[model samples]
Target: LFGKKYIVGGNFEYETELGNIKDGKVLKLQGLSQKHRIETTKMENMLSYNIFASLNLTEDFSLLGSYTSTKSKEYDSDSLTIGGKYKFNSVGDVVNTYFDNLSGNKNDRWRGTVNILLEAEDDSDRTYFDMDGNPYPGDYAASTLYVPKLTMSLNDLKSKWSYYFEGYYKDNEMFQGLKTNEAEQHATRVHLEARWNDTFSRGRYGINIAYRNETSEKPQNYGKKGFREVKRGVHQIRLTPNFIYNLGNGFALNGSFTNIYEYNYIGDKEGQGDFIMENQGGIDYSGLMPRAFMRLNLFREDTWHDHNNATERKRLTQIRPTFRYFFGNGAYTQLEARFPIYNGGYSNETRTQIIKSENYETRYGIKYIQPLAPGLTGTIGVTLLTIKAKNKATG
Candidate 1:
């Protein structure tokens, strides 16, 4: 005897912007010279809300819930969230005596979830860097955020097998003058699975295990003054046995093999010591290391139809390729390059570079679009970046 359902939704948004700039070394007689110019304009607004619910405490017991709220007063933010879920069922064994199947059901299952979040901000007219170092454009400044979460799952246990677990927590705050910034974070995850149907020949197989843990704190004008803190962990094991032979002409073959382990911890002690005398001219503090990677995927599908219009129109395609190689004990290898440009959709131009002893780095981009007719579209983009520092160590 049970039944219930409900849902609600909301949304509203608006944004505007304008800008102009000119100053090429004071216009040294260029085909077009605007001497020196600058213009700017902006406006913004946003609102959001959401709610949902479900319940059927019988014929297998069940319950669910959800909630979300958001508001953006021109960048001064706000946020919220709520969540819930529960389910239980099992049968076939006479003597199962209710109570959600003696608290252990077959075709079996158990689930749980919880969530909470809050945020706040006040920019204070902006412009900062005081305490005598210069640049003091003020409006005060304020910020806040907090989050919490939890999850649990166990499905089809007796008939085969499955398990999952998750956890999370966070807190952040910021304020200008007398300087005050704070941070905290925590994480946990676990999973397990096992399956072997088709008894002996027809085919189906599986085995998997995973684990992760994380911790962090040290934010408030960052590093140099935040008395840093960080910790990390990861472990994984996977073995898959898969097979399918329908042979009706649509061929198939699948494979899987994974083994991974990782660990990291960094508390920037003088930028992790001696990356050129503790980042001499500055930047490039390699701390926290331990890495590994191995991933692969392969898939194929085909279909076509036009045999006398039997209401059949079929066309299917799929192609996937991936490869990764990295090993333990602080491995290092990386390359990045970027170039960008786009207008309206928003992007003007952007470039980035990082040559860590030539491990690798490359990037490129360009974008610009603004066509309000025949397919309406708008875009703008711009970006540029480079890194490799530590040069100025003279006793």
Candidate 2:
């Protein structure tokens, strides 16, 4: 057995803007005046990095990993992951009393298994042109992804079934000024489930199914009449069903449902004539969405004559309530609002963007949490966002 653990964190953000541009549009110079201004300044910077790792090889095995890197002068991103697990018996050494076993069947009937996993990721970028202040290059891009996974659990063919499976593959590349594009993609998934119990009204039930597929190859742009190609495809299907009910004073109720489907391939002799895959003629689009959620809970406990009169019972309290609803059709909506002020000791967040134009956009924010001692904690927040666009016709 071997073990290792480490963590480090970092973050920095800065943004500044002062503006005026009358026929080169990108404006939001807040209530502009001062004779229609003509002087501008803008600056931005961001950086981040994170890494984590873990390993334990006995008492039911274990292994885990993570990585992240990011930078900005323009843009860069990275990611990675690894996994492991194993154990066939030892069954958590049979617990000491939770309503006295309540049927988890004591110990050792197949308690662990899941042995291989591999992951990968890549992101690419290049774009520059700041002129007189330096930096120049125009356009370039890249993308990559790979995944491998496997799992096992059938508990020696026992009657209350379970199963799982997953698969993935993806590749992509692009170049702007001389036109170059490459693409490859693949995916697979499988899952099976079963459960049944009823000793006079203690119930549980389940059912699930899933499938997916995707394909792509379309990118090319090296203007002045030369190079243009585009091609794409996608397909998907999914279904799920579930239920649980155990109300003996510590209430319980649950439910589930999901469905999806999509397919598309668009034109210029079906080789995406670049300028973002010009479909100016042939088109295919489809959409469907459904979601629902509900929750409720309450509990409290104290017994055994208050622990034989040594009297100490004050820990077991819970409360949960939730609700959600949704509907769709190429839909859109947004709203925003924010305001903030706090006394000294470094705290500032000023944000504002209220229901601005074209379709509907709104945003709102206000947050403050401060306690500089006794476990030290400090935070301040203010946000405002607005976006709305829909109007097109230029020939």
Candidate 3:
């Protein structure tokens, strides 16, 4: 890292020409990647980073090729990328981009090097579990990782895709990827995501799809028998399509639809793989101004699960409202509230659903924010009221 501000990178290239062809060349290849982080203000309270592959040529210029990943804690973003980059004056400005990008998509073009990366590093992490109200102490974290990220931008049509796979067959789960034929002894996790965005002059809209996979297999040499593929390989997929549009004066419309699918494997092949399907939707409205703004959102979700191959159904609805007003000297007061209008989780499951429930909870809170020092902001929040109400019926 270059002084905690910018990430440094280098490339090596060798180019040659073909003999008996007109305007044609055959070039051999190598590989390079870049990761950088830009420091933001304390008020932002975000962790932002970017990673991308390199396609270098000539003295100090190259067009961007493929594979880019960017993440931020605040704001729903798909991906931020550019056409090409040029380096002339300084080294820290390697990924520096000009505002006048060749691509017509002119939404979030950054000046100077703005990129990042996140690497999960650990010796070994463990977790504790409970079964039948009895504390069971045997859980493991993912120790190996192989992530391949990809992003593409053509004018206003953009996409970000990534895959994080933990381990393969016969490799050690507690170490890096190497050619081996041994028993892997620990549990693992997988994460994959794909998102697309279309940002124009008025507002932005996008669709996000994510997937998660996990395994809970036992150790290679544990329990009454040896390790097997008994309780392992579970999957979950979430698809969300969202939009926010401007309404000219002081109001905007926003909403999202979330669809989910799940699968799992248990004991031989007797257990089901596709066990659950969920659908959720939320609508939001915002009243905006220069110094103050407020937002209100309503949501509804319908989901189900499985146990012993007997499926059940569930449904819920929620409402959330928030308001914030800014003071003269960067001080602000905000209020937020959330309550469930309806919640039902039981509808004929003999294995796991013993009681049908509805009406879960209600919450409300308020907070004040003030600037304390150069790099600090003070916040005081209080939960004014909360109501927990549940109605149960016969199973």
Candidate 4:
């Protein structure tokens, strides 16, 4: 970020991990009961840091802030975040709070954020194959954990279409960081979008839709004493749609779809629900192959689940291909599933099992995207986090 009034950004990360592991030949005081295999050599390390800032003095007011920290052996954390954009409403602290200008455009309409967290714990990182649980591994007792989070954003930008609404909350969240279920969350989201691009003989298209809802708690943090981490209770819903098109001389077309639903409860056990669907379709090309481009995709997924009266189903399909080329500073490279391994060609890789988030089975792959300076770059991994939260909640 450069600066209009003010802007700042920062990041630092360090990580290391080394191979070979499989040690489970137990039977003593330093371990529990494993009864088998062994092979070793492992190493790990991690470190993280981040910093952020933003501010705009007039035209209704704006401000933001951030801080983050992490160390690992599972985790050790710290976080702090602040938010702003104001016209009316008053608050204390942060320099006595002042943001006069009462709506002269309210920075295009509201934005807010708040986050706080602190975590620390170490119980020798147990897990050596149960057997009377904690048969060994340090001594322990509860210690440290405090979490808080909130986010709110609402917007509607002039013409050409747009929509936004967002809300989220947390107080004891740790799902996806799962160290034995942990939860407490609330979420609300809405998005809408529209576009009619230009420049290829003046033709292109766009569409977007989104919805989300959530609530939760189960085995959530702050649970201990014989792992007394609560027991299920949740409700969730999600819906998404996306699209793109540019039938111009260079050709393009795209699609997307998703659905999710869930309900879970537990008392004496037995109560669950789930249904999910994932879809995709794509086509792209760059006539004449100069900077080169070609993309093709087709993917599908299905799922269903219900508790002890049982019902479960799962399905999947796939085919994704890409061959990209570009160079001259903003480097680029791509080749995926370009087949051939032990002779035969053609592949989309599949190992049959699916819960999704990919794990190449025979899916050939190659990637190279360089330009690591001048705004720095070198990254890949796209679209997820609920479809980028509807592309940043309608921009």
The most accurate candidate by TM-score is: 3
Model 1: per-residue lDDT, tens digit, 153-192?
Answer: 5556445555556656544432222224423433334444
TM-score of each: 0.23, 0.24, 0.50, 0.23
Query: In candidate 4, what are the lDDT values of residues 164-190, reduced to their tens digit?
Result: 444444443333343343333322223
Candidate 1: C-alpha lDDT: 0.34
- What's the ranking of the predictions by TM-score, best on top? 3, 2, 4, 1
lDDT of 3 by residue, 1-395 (tens): 21222223322222222232323222322231432222221222223333544555544555453332322232222232334445443322343345325553334322222122222332223222232333233332334433222222222112343222222222234247523433444445555666677777767988877787666554432233323333567777878788888776767777778777767664433354443333333333444567777777775666665555566656666677888888878889999887776442234344655555545556788989888766456677776444443445422
Q: What is the C-alpha local distance difference test score of each model?
A: 0.34, 0.40, 0.49, 0.48
- Model 2: residue 248 alpha-carbon error in angstroms: 61
Q: Candidate 2, residues 1-395: lDDT per residue as tens digits? A: 32533323333333332232221233343354422222222223445565655576565567766777766555566777688766555334333435436875545454546656666656545433232333332222445555565655535334454444444443442122222443333333433333332233755655555454444444443333333444555444444555565554434554433333333333322321111110011111111223333343332221111222232212222232333323242222222232111210111111221112222334464444454555444445555545434322210
Local distance difference test, candidate 3? 0.49
What is the TM-score (0 to 1) of candidate 4? Answer: 0.23
Q: What stretches of model 3 exceed 4 Å from their correct place?
A: 1-185, 218-230, 266-270, 273-289, 307-309, 328-331, 343-355, 384-395
Off by over 4 Å in 1: 1-83, 88-147, 157-160, 173-208, 213-215, 219-226, 231-262, 265-395
Error of 4 at 81 (Å): 41
> Which sections of candidate 4 miss by over 4 Å?
1-99, 102-106, 109-153, 156-234, 237-247, 259-261, 266-270, 278-301, 309-311, 314-395
Clash number by candidate, in order: 45, 11, 5, 3
Q: How far does residue 282 in candidate 1 sit from its true spot (Å)?
A: 56
